[model samples]
Target: MANFNEDGLKKKLDDLNMSQQSIQTVSLWLIHHKKHAHTVVNVWYRELITATDSRKLTFMYLANDVIQNSKKKGPEYNKEFGSKLGKVFEHLGALRLDEKSLRGLNRLLNVWEDRSVFDADHIKLFKKNLNKGHGKSKENNSRKRELGGKHDNPQSKKRRDSASDAIQPSTPESRLRRDSEGDLTQFAVSPQSSTPPSDPPEPEQLIEAIQELENAATSDALVREKIANLPDEVSDVNLLNKLQDLAAGRALCDQVEEALSMLEAYNKRLAEEMEARKAVARMLHDYIAFQKDLLAQAEETLEEHRQKQGKVKKVREELKAHLQNLPDISKLPSIRMGGLAPLPSAGDLFT
Candidate 1:
């Protein structure tokens, strides 16, 4: 379980990863404390705002997981997260993000749209704020680039040109395009297929199934009543002595035999029903265990993917830094024709 307080929530957020297990574990803890949904969501948003850019997307994923999963249990999480999502999206849009992060955010938006996680108007507003932020960021970047082009010294310009030649220009759009083409490919092959486990019987179906056995071991009401009212001679040997004649004694013996046969049949049926109930119990146990195994496997896969994504991000950053420091080819001196010694004629060189 997780605490709903700001510091406790912040610590959880700090350790969060993009894994499904990580997201679900935190989501369940929050849902368990859903009485404080409003306070929890506020803390989540506050932590999200201060989180590193990479972790920001993870936080969004956590919110998405929680909102959807907690819907069946209660509306608290959904409502709380819904109210804050607009601000979250606006903040995200304002940041100049790499292509991957932007795509991840857009994908989450699309899911929300498709699932009707929030009202259309609210979703539309979130999108509006997101796009507005992106536009603002792009405008600022464009202005900066324009100013740099105008004011750069010759050496700086040459270095810029050399860097550009060494690697593609690092415009936001270019980076997005590059990431879309290259980096995103790494995520295409999942560590494991996400196909869900076979569903267990619905609660209603299980209830009905169990209910069917309520009278399984018993005879019908009329039969039970008749058996209960059986003549005492069937069980009491002393009643045999009170018989009026051989005919009466024979009649009593016949009744006793009929009763004995019915009891034996009823006993057999009870045994069969007992076996059936035990089988059902065993099946239910196995079904639950199977589902648990599937859940564990899925969690393991998510953890692997999260670790791999982290490594990829680290490598991408290292590459970017390395590209920035490439030598300036534009500053290389030109070889003038006058400075070069004349080449010997082919015949003289051969001689």
Candidate 2:
């Protein structure tokens, strides 16, 4: 969380001796891929750039700044054409962030960065990333410090001594006397004590410890047995009952393992049956589609036949009318009955 923001990055970038054209090319590329660049940097960009050479570091900062500032939409936005020209330094390879920077970029493809709208899957993934970033090593060291295994600072040591001096040792008689008074506040830190009271442990820390213990018990037989025997020392009835229940559950699980195997087989068979039914349903759907197509073709053929029949009937009617309109040869003329006079003899009749 150093001053790795845009201004700081740009200042670093200005220190590099890259050519203007190369820088402009890089800037244009970043501008073209601004969205992807933003997403890549937001999640996986390390705050620290560990480069041996100052030039390389400058280039990295340059690339980082260009990507970061691309999303600004106000007056301060980089409106200048060559504003991201420092990007050319990335070609040196040293300017590139680790390839692992791609890890969280894919997660942002469809995810809204706003925490409020996260679904269960998104929340789960966010928690996983959180756990990855703040891993068990930090928690382990914290626990070691809590258990007094870590070296204390001189000031803390003196404070602890002062607090210890303020507390009084209790004997059975003193305990009985205090019990008679029914007052427990007497053991509280005195107001005049120079040492400040330690802050109460966070609920999250307590929950993490409980989960670790539960996981240890489940994973290790020795730890499980130790937990089962814990009630002997604590002498808490509720704790004992819970331990008994846990043991009973473990025993029951072992007893039912064969049954679980049978159930698994049954489930597998059921899944297979369901898949088969789905396949059959798909085939049936295809068959129905094919039948529908055939029916459509048949209907089209029937329509064409009907059209052709109508055309044939029209033609027949026209022919019949034409035939009826024609004059009757018997009424029109009897060639043999003499519609004209006979021809005269060629020579004598003429004279």
Candidate 3:
């Protein structure tokens, strides 16, 4: 059970070279065990579905294996397995597998390919489900390519070339910031003011662009068109060269995502450091306050002792004064007072 954890699954995947065969076995176990299935899915399936396009193929293969194996398990178990497998397909569709991939799945799952297999609703749902799942990324990528082409236009190139020779060529830091913003700025049509705009956009404009991009980078046609027009003027020569190699398509998005990811990590580290410093500062503050309180208490106690000593001294002085006030016994006259008793009792009685 413990081995079913993320690390264990990760290690297993790594060990198996991310084999679909292994995933099928594990996923089957996860599906059959009704109580723990959701836990396992919550732990790993979401991540698994988002795996790369290649890994997606592996998942599709895994589904085929489940279908083939279901025959031996009888109709009730077969029905259950089919239902669970359908759920997985839904996940894949949500992840947006392409039509080609889905068609490949059709062949692999023996759907339209095998006459022996009864056509189920699940099978019928495949194409519809994939189209629904295909969602926005595909469109965004298409728009990005279109925009990348227009970006290298003669007019834009002229402007860039003119700007390239301008003083204060972009520093690496500024370039990185621009690339970072690129992720957030989706396509938009530039305002048709005849006047030539500044080579580098104003900071506020860049911020506005980023906000627009973040909001509509998904499927907005207008935003897509605007993003498509953005010049690929990243100042890092090496990175620019790489972007060029990727046909300047989705690679830019990848780089932007990467940069943002790194930035997030850096920000997280800074926050943690700040929190640690705050904790230390708090401890020092408490310690200093405690020391001040101790000093204050000690002074108060010392004053109390001094007051007691003063009272004792006053008593001593009074006692000395009273003793000194006593009159001298030698100087005083000696006073006599009275009387003797008789001793001869027997003789007195006879008389």
User: Where does model 3 exceed 4 Å of error?
Assistant: 1-10, 13-44, 74-81, 84-91, 94-100, 112-119, 132-351
lDDT at 106, model 1:
61
Per-residue alpha-carbon lDDT of candidate 3 for residues 1-351, written as tens digits (9 for 90 to 100): 222455765554443223322443344433333233344444444545657765666554443433333343334434544555556667766765665455444444433223233366655565445446565454344333223334465664454323221211233433343332232122121211111121122335444544543433243456446445544553244655454555564767665665556556655655665665555455445444434543554576588679999999999999999989999877665444223344568988899
Greater-lDDT candidate between 1 and 3: 1
| Residue pairs in candidate 1 whose N, alpha carbon or C atoms collide under 3 angstroms | none
TM-score (C-alpha, index-matched) for candidate 1:
0.42
Best-to-worst ranking by TM-score? 1, 3, 2
* Stretch of 10 with least lDDT, candidate 3: 189-198
Best TM-score goes to which candidate?
1
For TM-score, candidate 1 versus 2, the one ahead is 1
At residue 166, what lDDT does model 1 achieve? 16
**lDDT assessment of candidate 2:** 0.38
Error of 1 at 208 (Å): 31
Worst 10 residues of 2 by lDDT: 191-200
Q: What TM-score, computed on C-alpha atoms, does each candidate reach?
A: 0.42, 0.23, 0.27
